[model samples]
Target: MTTIVPPKERECERCGRTDTWNDDTGTWAVVERDGDRLSGDPFCLHEWDINGAYNPLEEGA
Candidate 1:
């Protein structure tokens, strides 16, 4: 048996900005922060921390 699960949301460890996966649009949409919607902040570089700890795809698929 095989199963695939993708991350639903990801947050910047630096600025705390968050985004939610939108299956309908096939994109990550910015989630509102404190009632205000924003794409990002001036301080955050927006670089994804994808390293050995994270895998976007299945291991052997």
Candidate 2:
């Protein structure tokens, strides 16, 4: 039997904002806003490179 695992949640290091990977949309959606910065206009302005990796997936055979 094979088991499928969900992607891990990602949080911003600067403001504590949280997001989750949406497999249906193939994108990340904001689930929680920690402060004004993340809650204000342009929801996600943080640099992802500095945020580090959030999810891990196995390569298909």
Candidate 3:
């Protein structure tokens, strides 16, 4: 049996509320505000692990 890595339940930087992705849309629940800052966005986990986007929390976890 193959094990899938579950998406991390992360707290939004802006709202501080926890959210996750809706596998169907493949998008984050919250919108990213910072232009300069990268990672930890709504779907940062997916981006970092699956899509290869800017993910700052990669090292800490």
Top candidate when judged by TM-score against the true structure: 1
Expressed as tens digits, the lDDT of each residue in 1-61 for candidate 2 is 9966555556565556666677887767777544433332355455432334334442221
Candidate 2 — worst ten consecutive residues by lDDT sum? 52-61
Total residue pair clashes for candidate 2:
0
- Between the candidate structures 2 and 3, which one is better when assessed by TM-score? 2
Candidate 3 TM-score versus the reference = 0.31
Model 3: CA > 4 A from native: 1-8, 13-15, 30-61
What would the per-residue lDDT of candidate 3 be over residues 9-57, giving only the tens digit for each residue? 4454453544455566655554345543334445343322333343434
Cα deviation in Å at residue 27, candidate 2?
A: 0.4
Give all TM-scores, in the order shown. Answer: 0.59, 0.44, 0.31
Please give the CA lDDT of all the candidate structures. 0.65, 0.52, 0.45
Name the top lDDT candidate. 1
Give me the runs in candidate 2 sitting further than 4 Å from their true place. Answer: 1-7, 32-61
Going through the candidates in the order shown, the clash numbers are: 0, 0, 0
| Candidate 3, run of 10 with poorest lDDT | 43-52
